[model samples]
Every structure is written in structure tokens, then in C-alpha cells.
Target chain A: MSFHLGGDKRASLAEAAARVGDGALVALGGGLCARLPMALVREMVRQGRRDLHLVGSAHSIDVDLLIAAGAVGVCEESYVGFEQDLGLAPAFRRAARDGSVEVRESCCATVLAQLRAAEAGVPFLPVRGIKGTDVEGLHPEYARMTCPFTGEELVVVPPLRPDVALLHAPLGDAHGNLHLDQPFVLDERFAHASVAVVATVDRIVPTAELVGAGVVVPGHLVAAVAEVPYGAHPSSCYPGYAYDRPHLAAYLAAATAGGTALDEYLARYVHVDEDTYAKDVDPERLAAWSGSTRAWQELFR
Target chain B: MSWALDAGHAAQRSWTLDEAFVVALARTIRDTEAVFHGFASPCAQVAMHVAKRTHAPDCLLIEGATYAVDPVPVFVPPTGNDLALHRDAVYRMRFEEFFDAACRGAVDRMFLSGGQIDGYGSTNVTAIGGMPHPKIKLGGGGGGGNISASIGALTVWTSRHRAGRTLVADLDFLTDLGHRTREGSRAELGYTGGGPQWLVTELGAFDFDGDGHARLRALWPDVDVDDVAAATGFELRVALDGADGLLDPPSPAELAAVRAVDPLGVRRSEFAEVELARTPGLSGVAR
Candidate 1:
């Protein structure tokens, strides 16, 4: 691989954040409480980046936190609610309620279909489910096509190519060979779907350590790899840590209470780097992080 | 004794609305059949697990978020994607792979809930008000559109079956394409699966009639037929004459199994917190 395309892609979280420009469309990896780049997002908030576009990143705290920090302009969402217990995400709710964030609603399936189209280097892809749905009528960007042979109606979704992908992996080499601990079916597709992929990993191991069968995001696809251990805190990272329930609960509370409470949350936790934040927070709670639900595994066994 | 079978003979009258609804949904699970549950489906997860433990012991499970069927954990993580479900996963596949399987005719059943479902069974999870931008934006379909088109039997469940917000006369936007404008729409799309087979709500159970409209098939106890009709925004097609076709409450065996799977009671969270407080020493008999 040429040095320009695939060389030492190692950098600090701030450097990785710098690579993303204003109004760049970004793909978020491992959404819904797993492997979100929390530190990179926090660093982006610190850097005061604006007008960033988020795609396929809805329905999780990852996007909620960024939107709360006022870093997003446009968002293409499949789903955008918090868990049933957590109610709606506060920032996202306020943003959507006020129409500040230019919101485009796509089904969860459509996002994957769009990403798959991008991965395959196709201009547009036809989906069987889009017809006769509100998702069809709302977006003029989506058009209906009659199958030439069958004369069947189908929705044609245009290709979605993100400028960058914000991803978190369990381990990676200094050369940027990222290995995700879970199945993570969408990571590779998102990486190929984007012009650049930046990842925050828990550990940077030798190239040899990333061997064997697993979900591997190869060095060539990754533009930068920053070591932000526990980067996925408040969200689970396999074999590294589980989701911080208390932290998540705190965030939910703050988000629910809104106003100065949210600002305080940003100041207390997000404003600080991982180290000082970790020091301020309880280590015992952080220790709750683990690879899998061992309790569930043992129960089934 | 394990809650799995320690359950005693509790009369059907003792069942909560949610419990009765779950049992009603579970009865549809045929033995030795593959059923797929999608995102934000905690109630259906509990129902599927109960179905496996009771009547449909051999019924297979394929969860959308975790992609694990018959998850060992009785409790679904509040996060729609429960990692516990990933333990000993049978066949983990993405939504795209599953939808592709449906396109090729693989998935037999799917359970989905939405913000709004119309009389025709077309689900609208895309927008609450008129399109372009909705008054209330909802979580969009993960793959419900393809699943409803492909899955032979799509069981649509909702906790609160209110009018306007839920059981609408017509959808503002269509999230899952159930039966197009007319009956032949699926055929036009080359979809093989029967669209939106069953609809489960708080008050009653429903299915599409020969005319491709939501026909109330059964009602839970204490639910008035007229009340259900009034709750539905559209004119509903009442299939059953009376309590004649109404399903009995879940058996003590099924209830026990449901309890074992949902020890935390996440499924009944739609009710206020006061619902959790018992009258006096019922330990945990109430939903």
C-alpha cells in the first residue's frame, strides 16, 4: 500500500476529530449501545465543530450527545428514539420539535440498503418495501419505478456516500487494522460507503495480534486510528467494557431535566478528557464494563 | 420452585390487558415455525419466549436487533439489541440479509409494532402528521417494509391502541407496505408473503378479512366491542359476532413461562409506576 493511502494512520482523538470538516456527512458505527466513538464525539464537541451531517446514527446516545453539543446540521434517520425506559432523547427531541436539525426520515432498512448501494458502487438501488409508505411520499429524492419485466412498483433509493465514518473498535494495530469484537455486520459496508473511516479503539496492538477470524476493518480502509480506551463507555465495548448503566441513567436524567442540567452534564463529563473524567467518576462503576452478558450466557448454559 | 412451572391455576379474569394481549399474540405461533421479531419489540420477545415454553415448544426464534432466537435470557435489555440474545445465536444475520431472505422467500413470520397502523394494516412509522416533516417524528422502519412484504404472517402489536395516534383511518405516511392500495398490490410488487396477517391491540385481536381490511377477530375480557370500534379511527370490520371467537386468557403454564422470561416486567412498562405497586401482599402476581 502507498504511504498516502495506507501508512501509519495513528493519531490523537483531537487529530482524528480535525480530519472531519464542517458539513461532512458521517456514518456512525455500532449504534444502539455498542462500540460508539464517545471520546471522538466529545473531542468534536470540544473543538466546536458545526454543520456536520449524521447518517445512520439515530436512535442512540451517540447521536444524541453530539446533537446535544450542537455539532450537527443535517441528520438522516431510520429510527430516533431512546429505549422505552429512557423515553425520547432530549437533544434530538428538542431539535426535531423546533426543526433546527434538518431531519430526513428513512427506514432502518433503507439506510442499510442505501449503504449497500454505496458499497457496491451503484448509483441507485430498488427496494420492495418503500412503495405505498409515507417514507415514499415525503422525500422527492426517492422515486418510484415500475419493474420493466414484471411491471411491479418499487422505490428507488439513491446512493448515500458519507464523507467520513466515526467508528469504535475493540482493538487495532498502529497501522490501523481494526478488529471489532462483535459480529457488526454493517461496519465494513459503512467503511466502504464513506470516503474516509476514522476509528477510536481501546488498545493498539501489533499487526500480528489482529489475526484469526473476526470482523476486521482492514488498515487500507481506515484513515486514522486513535487509542481512546473505554471510548465506548456508557455504551458496551466487547471484551473491554459493558455499558455504564449509571452514566447512561445520569445522561437520561440530565436530558430529561434539560436546560442548565444538560449544560452541567456536558461540563462535568463531556468537557473533560477521558482521563480526568474517569478520575472524577467512580472506577467501580467503570469496572462494570465487560465483553458479553456473562450472566445471560451462564443462565442459558 | 422455578417460575417456569411453579405457576398455579389463575383464572382468565385475573389477567391484565397486557398479559391477555401477549397470550393472544402467542397463540398465533405455530409449532416448529421460524418467527422473526424486530427492533423495539420487548413484548413480542416475551410472547415468543412464552410461546416456545408453552404450546409452540419447537417454534424457532429470529430476533432482528440481536438476531438470536429463543434468547436464553427471560429479560430483554431495555436497549432493543439485547446482547444476552446474542449468546449461542442460531443464525445471526443483518436486517438486509433477512430482508434478502424474505425476497427469496425464507422468513415465515415477523412481529412488528409501530406508531400508527391503519385499517388496511399499512403501518406508518415514518411520520405522525403530514409528510415532508411530521409534527411527531418516530423511529423509522428498520426493515418492516420488506418484512411485511416478505414475511407470510406479520403480527402487528401495540401497547396503547388509541385512535389518531395509532389505529388511524388512513396513514399520513406508510412505513411498512402491507396491502398497497388494493389487494393485488403485493402481487404487483412480486411479494409472495401475505401482507400484515394479524393485528394485536390492548382491547382486542384483529386480522385481515377477505376484503384486505382489519377485521376484529377476538377481544380480551372486559373490553366492549363498541369501545374497540370507537377507539379505532376507521370503520373496523368486526369478524366475530360476539365473545364466540374471543380467545381465553393465557394458561397458567403460559403465564408462568412468560413470568420466567420477563422477571423484570419490562413489557408492562406502558402502565404508570403505580401499576407496579400491589394492593397488599401479592408478591409479584400482577403484571
Candidate 2:
């Protein structure tokens, strides 16, 4: 069967984390500043699930928070600034000092390669271009083999078939067809590579209306769907709505501050419910702040 | 010449006679041997073109962006430094491994330019106000001016209106320091490579003096030193015997090669029409 009706769309992020299994390759949607499911990600960390392998592009604030909380076991790429979203020098420095995170090269490509391998039904794909750099030694799971003809070392990237994939979309129908104009990086690929795909949409429309609207993700790949209004909020859908810059700014300040500063910051901002946090944060406050607000602000603003 | 012919065929309709100038400059620099190009630089394109065509067919083209030698043309969609292409190369590397390469003397020649370069070959690509927080935030200088000053040799290029942008006084920010301020400082800092060698501009080229300061070396034919002096915002001291050489108008082949790599003419786009009109002679050279 292509459909399952085990969960409610209005369920909390913590409840969603319960659905994810151990060692499952999870692809989180959203860009460096887009509407990411940070609430679910935080719950995953609080639950202390080490078996899950996380991957994404740029640095998602949610990802950094999880890593900071000691919930993440391995990260393939570096975490950018909490404000500027440029270099993750500070985060990497802290991670190095703590010796908790394993910094790998090409987080996006490595994850993409795994998805590609799985989609192709191949055990491994021979990838060129990553031979000599630091990425090779970081992920021992992928071996480096030499080409007999050219004598060049090629990375043998193993297939990534995620047990479950979690994604957020702008809208969907009860039948589970997703629709989104933005957040189009590797969402489709992640869906195809996973055994089950769980998508959260902003609102649910009639299947006929969605089909006629030409915004669809073909019900075949999607296993379940949930309608969560204003879901993308602070993470933004781009062109649909601007990011909640003030909330992002506060998160960045707390994130980079470290020690009790980070803890207090997360408690006041991140840990709270979406409604309460939204009401508390005045989006217009970002307009008043001059200069580069923080790394995260650069992602959207 | 044979490589040029091959490149011509590869570029097809995009190849024009103007490319020869870039090709020639590349050849000139390649002949010098052991030249380095900075990240996301047009000079890198010229250097690579010259290396592939002439002296160093087998020369190691080191890149800060990516390590891979793309088989496709240099100007292709992804270009050379797309992280997707090079991610696997440095996979799993600790920060120390990358720093080791920079700390060591493995890097040779480098290319850099300052927002305001003074009589001394010093450049400032940093913020003008202050550190920790500046009133205006200029992007961080990649490796400070250390790469230019410490590398075996350095090449500096500026396309800005000389008089307005190029200056007389020291810069507000020290983007890249040409050389160590004090004697014996090089050894103290563990730097052993050579310092700034050539400063190329639309007007012509300049080089450092014995004390490692800028001295006008050569001017293009049909251009007078007075015009150059007028164009410069700073007081430029020309060498007593400074001579004028036909700044070989870029050969058709050289211009074609440069245009092929940069179709939009990112270099020329930086200049204003008023500036271009003021320097009619330089305009012809740019075209």
C-alpha cells in the first residue's frame, strides 16, 4: 500500500522524532535560513538518538543546535556562522575542542552521492574529484580506490537508502501529494531514496484542486502527509513569505554565545511553542538593527 | 602555438582574435615559471590558459578553491571551484591538514590587489575603521597580505580608475602587507618565500625597489608619464630612467582567449564610461 494513516498532522515535533529509526539517513529540507523543522530536531537531540545520520547543505540553525546539544554523532560538512552564514570557524573550533563532532568534507555531495547510489540500485558509485582533499579520510565508510588506467584515486561512495525521510512543504492534499515552489534543492531525491517519506505542509487542499494547480509531488513517493499552518514561518518559503528575521537573530545570538548564554537563549526562543515564540518576537525589530545582524540573518535577509 | 590552435578549435565560435593578449601575458608569466593565482581571480584564468599553452604543460596548477583539474573548458557552468566538484578531495580532513599547506612554503607565486595600494607595495583589503568591529565592514582579506609578501613572487592587478582609486597615503585597512615591517621578521614569522614582484595595471606595470617599495618600471607606448601621474590619486615617483615600451596591445588571439573565459567582461564592467572616455588610449587597449 502507498498510504498509511497512523498519525495526526497536528502532532508536535517531538512526536515526529519518535517515528525516525536508528541509523536512518534523514534528509532535512530548508536552506541556511529557510523554515526548518527545528522543533522536531531539538526533540531528537533531547531524546539522545545517536543512530541517526543527519545531512544537509549550508548550515541549518537546527543542525547546529543539535550538534551543540551533543545529540549529533557525525556531521559531513562544517557549520557556518550563527549570523553571517559564511565560515563555521567558531563552531568547528568549539567542536574540535570538545572532540565530539567528526568534521567531514563535502557534506552536501557526500549525502547526494549516497542518495544517488541508492536511487541507481548500486552498492557504490565511483566518484571523481574528491581524491586528495581531507574529505577522504573523514568518512571511512566510503573507501578510496585507485584507477588502474589513470592511477588516480577515486572515492567509492556507498549508496544511501534512508529508512525514513522528513520534509516540510508549503501545501499538500490529504492523499499526500506535496507542492512547493521553493526549498527545491534535494527534496525530491531524498524522497525517492528513502523507504518512507513524511511531509508536513502548510495547508491541505482538495486532491483535484492540487492536481489542477500543477503543484504536486506525485502521491507515489510520499507515504504520509500532515497539514501544519504557517509551518515555514521563521524558516521562510521564499517569495511566499519573508523569514522571521528577529527570531533568527535572537537564535543566532544565543547559539554563538555558548555556556549558559546558549542555554538561556534556547530556552527563551527555540524550546518554546511556535505560536508563543511568534507572538513574542517582533519581526520588525530586525529593521532597527544595523550592520550584519548575524550569520543566520545573511541566509535570508 | 599548437596548443593555441587546439584551444581555438575547442572554443569554436566563441574564440576571437582578442584572446591572443591574455594568451601572450599568460605565456610571458609562464616563462617566468612558478607563478600562483588567487581564488576566484581572472588572473587565474589567464595563468591557466598560458600554462596549458606554453612552458608548463605539466606545471602543477595549485588552487585554493578546488584541487581538481576540470577536463571541460575553464568557463563552463560549474567552473573550477564549485564545492560539489572538490568536496570529495578534502573529505574528512581536519583543519590542521589544510593549514599545514598554507603554513608551509609549498605555495609559490600569488596574485592580490589592494583597495588602496601605496608607494610601498602594501595593499589594504580589510575594513577601514577598526577591528573587533569596524564602522564599515569590508570583506576579510583572504590570508592577509601574507600570501603576497611571503610567496616566492606576487602579481598585483587593478582595473579601477588609477587617480581616484589608487592612492598616495597608506590605506585605511592593511588588507595585505607587502612585506614584513622590520628586518629579520620574515624568519621570525617562519616565512621564507620571496615578496611582491610585479604590479600590473591598465596604465602599465610597476615593480618594488631595493627597500621593497613601488617604483614605476614601464609605461605603454603613446602614453606619457604625466598622464599616468595625473590619473593616479597619489604622488608616484617614477624611476629616473623610466622608459616607454609598446605595451603590446593584446594580440587578437589573447583578447579572444580572455573573452572566451569571461563572456560578460567582468574586468571591463568595473569601469565607468566617464573614466573610460577620459582615458581614450587605455580604452583602445581594453577593447
Candidate 3:
């Protein structure tokens, strides 16, 4: 993995999004509507990035928006749907059905194993169960080999090294050291496996303050960092805010309708700068997320 | 265990299909088992909670999206990964840790559902047609393929069975392995878990036969073998007990526990509008 040692690694939102080149394999760092890098995602849409391949475990609107914007050509995620809140992701469903996007379906454990292999600098990793299903047949690269000690057959998956890892955390330093809260699904592993890591955080605290938050990702592992408050708006960044269900519902309605409805939505939201978008999302509503548990529960209602 | 019928009618209470469905699912888990259900599964989530509250208090209840262990939520939220589910959790399980534990066969039971479930218990959540290109793209099955083989037993459930599209003869693709496929049996393939131990649907509950095919074992209120045959794509085989398989709805205790855990009735979202409207408590429940 590549690293940027020592010096300040802060960059603007545009610059951070630009680091992810066209067609780069990006490992998005979040699982299902939490701590997703939405500010950077909007920035990439505004910049008109194209033909990107996204890989992740469980996801929702983040990947769906990119596919809706025609930025993604290959989707290797295990699950990409709104769990319980809604149903299937609208744009992703349409893209896959139309054969516009290549869906290289992989499971959560397999994806984790591949990333672990890359982090360990191993060629492949053996998984316990995945052999006796049709999912295994989709990936021709998966090889079956007998264990050396016990004659048991195992499925060996090749290492997955993403070109970039896009993440959004709660705290970070100018030197790019990240402090993510708990339930940081695979971001640390993503940092270790990817060639470069790009992140957006809610606050840029002092290095000491970041260390206190728990520096899960060291400065040396990161290529760039951007301070974008409410960077994960419409998706919760724990202890900061809760996901905006109304906003997400509006987004789904527009995406499901397609045509000019979706076009108008993109123009109104995705095309704008972070500051403008933030203003559009009423501050009072966001404040409610930071209140007691009752307020947090009210957001879903 | 035979539930006392007098206790049910004492409160002059009625039950919905979803509540009964949850009870049927909860019955699959033993008190000693560690059960897991994935994200977007409110029915299974409520079922696990009911089981823990009623018969299986010692059972380890794991949250799907958040991986919280033995969580004591105030109420089941519509979303899976929120702090609502993680409240008062005994321990938070890491993403990889759950998979590793299941692989080692530490996890006893897991609830799985598919876009299409075949007679052999193989499921398809990947696509509708074929791979690479498909007529319809369902949300991919998250770790179901790997964990289905690793866990102790699988409780397969589906709400869309009445539509005649869910229980199919052949799947477009097999996302999780069942008892046996065209290639061979799961034992021959070295899978640790007992494939599909039970299949619970809106119409009835099914148990695997000697040959590992889904055989209808129990029918819900007013559901007969003909009704199940009409909905299922494959040939329906009834249990040898026949009419005796017609089972009672969930008892008053089970229904009360189900409503307590799911105050907002998040499990109702899993069923169709018609199904909800047909049931007394389901459609009129206050949000």
C-alpha cells in the first residue's frame, strides 16, 4: 500500500474526489447508510467522473447515486439495498436489469477474505464455505484445493486490491490520521488493502485529540483528507448526526420516477457545492439528530 | 408444547398472519442455539426477539446490520444498523468476527430468505435470468452463500409465496446451497451446516423429506394443501398426517411478546398490502 508520510495532507472536497481517477476500482468505506462519503460522492458526480468500479459489502444510496449518474460500470458489492427503510435500490436495479452495469456479485465473507489477503500480501486466502453454491460458479477465478494437513476442500479467493479507498470518518488530523467511531465496517482493512486512501471527516481536530478518539488509520496510510462537516449527510455519522430519511425518501422517489424528475434532483442537489447543499438541508433538522434517543427515533418517523 | 387455548381467548384478542408467521419462525430456534438474522429482515428480527422473550431466553440474539450481540432494544426500528438496535447490547461483534465464528460452527441458527426458493432449498437472490446479464436484479445475498453452509441450521422464510413467483421449481441462480443440488449433496461438498432445516411461508411450514425436498408439514388457518399447491411452482407433497397438520395460530403469550418487541409493527412491511388489509390487527395497528 502507498503512503504519504509526515506533512499535512488536507485537500479541498473537489481535490479529494479528483484523486479517485476515472475507471479506478474504489472500495467505499461504510456499510448500509452509515458514515458514507456522500459529500465526496456528490463532488465526483459534479465533476462527471465515469466508468468507475465500486466494491463494498452492504451499501445503499451511495453506490446507487453513482450508478444513476452513469459513473459506475462495474458493481462488485455483496448487497446494495435499503434494509427495511425501503426495499431495493432503484437506480442499481435498473442498471443491472438493462445490462448497462456489470454485476460481479460477491458475498461479505469472501470480500473480507480477499481484502485480508491483500493486506497480508498473500496471493489468495482460503474460505471455509462458498463452494457448493451457484455464487461460486460466477467467479471463475475461485479455485478449489485440498487442505495440506486435513484433506478438506476449500475455496481460495484471490486478493482484492482497490485502486483507492473512499471513506468518511468523525475525526481526523491535517496529517490524515483518522479516528473512526465503532462499527467502522472494514475501513481499516480498506485502508490497508487499497493503494491510496482518501477520506472526508466531520472535524479536523489536533493530532492529540484525534489520538484520543483512537487513531485507527495512521497518517502514513492516507493519501489525502478533506474536512467536510456533515460530509455523510442523509447517512448517519455516529455521535454527530442521524440519517435523513425524508431526504433519502425524496431521492428514492425521484430516482424511481427517472426522466426529468431525477435530472431536476441532480441539478438541485448533486450539482451544487457542499456549502450550498448543506444550506438546503435545514440546520434545525440536523440538530434534532444530535439530541436524545427519542429525537433520533423521530427522524425515521 | 401444546399452548392452552383458553389463555388466548381470555383477552378476547386476535392475531395477524405476520404475528403467527413470526411465532412459527421462532419455534425453529431452540433455547440453546445462537441465532442470527441479516439486515432488512424485520419478520426474522421480531421472531428472534419473541423467541428470546418467551421460550428461548438463554438464546443469543444477534442483530444483523450492526452485529450487536444480545441487544435489548426499546423497540425494533425500521432500520437495522441504527443505534436503536444496538442499545444495551451485551457486545458489539465486528464484521469479520461474525463470519469467522460462523465458519468455526459457533453460530447455531441463521434466518435466510430469497427472491426465489426452490424445492431443493437452493435460493436465488442474485438475479432472475442468468449471470452477467439478467432480466431482473435482486439485492445480492449478503454472506448467505458462505454462512448457509457454516451455521448449524437455516430457517428459510418468505412472505411472497402466495404470489406463485417466490417458491419456484428452478432458480435463475443459486445464491445459497441447500441440502443437495444437481452436482451433489451438501455433505459430499463438505459444508458444515445442515442445509435448510425448515421452510416457513405465508401459507404454511415445510420440512425436508428423506430426499431433501420441501414437503408441506403444517398449514396456517384456512390454508389447505390445494392452496399451497396452487402457490408453489413444484409438486406439493403433504406430510403423512394430512389434515392433522392444520395448526393453531400463535398463542396469546407469543402474540403479546411479538407486539411488545415490534411496537411500530416493522414486520408488517414484509407483507403485501392485501395481506395486511385482510388481517384485523395488522391493518388497524396504530403507528
Q: What TM-score does the predicted chain A of each candidate obtain versus native chain A?
A: 0.91, 0.78, 0.97
State fnat for each of the candidate structures.
0.43, 0.00, 0.70
lDDT of 2 by residue, B194-276 (tens): 65676666565677777666667766443567767877764576773432331334445555556564443433333445434
TM-score of each model, paired residue for residue? 0.89, 0.50, 0.95
lDDT of each candidate versus the true structure: 0.71, 0.51, 0.85
Residue range A62-85, candidate 1, lDDT tens digits: 888888888999877676666665
Q: Put down candidate 2 lDDT per residue, A174-230, tens digits, no spaces.
A: 667777653255566767777777777776888787877665466667665656555
lDDT of 3 by residue, A1-301 (tens): 6467869999999999999889999999988888898998899999999999998898998999999999998999999988867888999999988889988888999999999999999999999877877788878889999999989989999999999999999899999999986677888889999998999999999998888878988889899999999999888887777778889998999999999999989999899888898899864475675567677667777
Which number leads on lDDT?
A: 3
RMSD (Cα, Å) for all candidates, in order, is 4.7, 14.7, 3.2
Error of 1 at A152 (Å): 2.7
Rank by DockQ (best first): 3, 1, 2
Instruction: Considering the two chains of model 1, state its CAPRI-style docking category.
Output: acceptable
